[model samples]
Target: MGKVSTFSPAQQAENTSSKIVVALERLSEAFRVLLWQEATQYGLSPIQIQVLTFLLHYPEEKRTVTSLALYFNMTKATISDAVKSLEQKNYLVRKPSETDTRSHSLHLLKEGRAIAKKVEHFAAPLQDAVATSPLKEQGVLLDQLMQLIYQLNQEEVITHQPMCFNCQHYTEKKGNYCTLLKISLKQANLRVDCPSFETRED
Candidate 1:
């Protein structure tokens, strides 16, 4: 067998950011491969599985095709196809929107919910590895990732999604709060993908 090469940070002294790029690419590819394997067991595409998982976690109002397209950074047509596939498989159901009878909202069926639960844990290996790290280190890693995502959104490199910290509705005074919802926010309650997120003007 051919020898596998590893990334060498020492050789990338001239451009340290190259190492981060390589690491991120490798992590993304690894996760995609693992997700694909898990998706195939249910005879579903990765995007379809992702939709089901999103519906499982998000409220019904946020499960519209338009919202999903924006969240996944895919075109509406592509998201429509995936939704149709899931519907045909009886993994998802559509109900007419209460506010707009012409539009529909997606909901996962029992089978879809089961698959979502399974796929959700498909990254247990990665999670287990992270679990071995010190808590402070883990927090640092999460914060750094969140910052990177925030930067990407700011740059418009990816479609904007609901993140409490980046939303106009978010307020920080004596404590974190949501001005629109008039609710206090806990650190753990900070949503990474809020349905009601409105971008704050710079």
Candidate 2:
């Protein structure tokens, strides 16, 4: 072979990791397709829909334009444009941040919350497929995915995921433990996106 490439069928035939990477890429495309379908129905761009959906559940700490930009791997200007559009549509409002006078945070309006709730299920097809798997398998998959996300964050391939693995509250003595809650965690109890996550210092 000339080289080992993910796109090479010959390599993928032998490399399990390459195949998994290809599968993940395909799943990402599915996400985009589902998002676009919902976006068009609501007369919103895909990014705008994502912003509203994220704001609906995440806390105020992660609701600023800079935070959104970093989370989505987009520029601040792009997030600002989307936020402005949402404001004009009365979907959300920008309030002065309690922590930062110069910076403001976003809050979804009544209409915005409604839209986010509706569009959040756009990937129900994907979830429904995974839901058919055995609960034990689901638990294993979740653990594996969480580990992958943690590694990706370590490599700076992704940014600020707010997950349990990198959380200050998390530790593994015999099993997963939450220092903040003083509770032992099962695989099912682990959070991939935890609202209460505080970044652990190295």
Candidate 3:
């Protein structure tokens, strides 16, 4: 019988690390696919459904395409296309921003609101089902996950530069803001430090 050469300690460690990374990626990808499938079965594309759901909670804010693009880490062209399609489908309306002549805002139409409510109602049961774990264990797990997220976000804030230091969208005054947005410039600048920040074309 021929004896096989076993992996060295460093090689074994590398293999273990690589396996962990791949497993994590696979798990993430599976979750994404499952979520996408659920959204699609509800007769809405994932992005459309997300936009609809977001607008329901913050109906007063007529968000611009640029803002949505930045928030979603989506391309300007993709946002523009989605906005156009939604507008054509009568799910949303594009109107000129009252404050900024150069920008436009998205408003969900009445029909869009109705559809969003229906979709959200349908998904609530699934959400509940997925979260119906033992209370004590669930609480502990959630708390730990929240702590992990907070730590990760804190690390991001320390590592990333704030937009206030570079982006023209930021202003120094207590409540100064871009003409297009209702939010304070300081808050907008703070968003740059977010781990999720994505650039948008103005």
Candidate of highest TM-score: 2
Q: Give the per-residue Cα lDDT of candidate 3 at 138.
A: 60
lDDT of 1 by residue, 37-70 (tens): 8888878899887888888898877899998999
Clashing pairs in 3: none
Residues 11-111, model 2: lDDT tens digits: 89999999999999999999999999999999999999889989988888779999899889899999999999999999999999777799998999899
Residue pairs in clash, model 2: none
Candidate 1 overall lDDT versus native: 0.82
TM-score per model over all chains: 0.80, 0.92, 0.55
Question: In model 3, where do residues sit more than 4 Å from their true spots?
Answer: 1-27, 121-126, 134-136, 150-202
For model 2, the stretches where C-alpha displacement exceeds 4 angstroms are: none
Between prediction 1 and prediction 3, the one with superior TM-score is 1
Model 2 weakest 10-residue run by lDDT:
1-10
Relative to the true structure, how large is the alpha-carbon lDDT of every model? 0.82, 0.90, 0.59
Compute the lDDT of residue 164 as modeled in candidate 2.
Answer: 83
- State the weakest 10-residue window (summed lDDT) of model 1: 3-12
Highest-scoring model, lDDT: 2
User: What local lDDT score does residue 156 receive in model 1, on the 0 to 100 scale?
Assistant: 93
Greater TM-score among 1 and 2 belongs to 2
Error of 3 at 154 (Å): 5.7
Encode model 3's per-residue lDDT on 1-202: one tens digit a residue: 5532233445446576555545556656765676577577766677777677666765344377776775566778987887777788899887887777888778889998888786655455445754887666665654444444445545763322323333355444645454334466432133434332233335
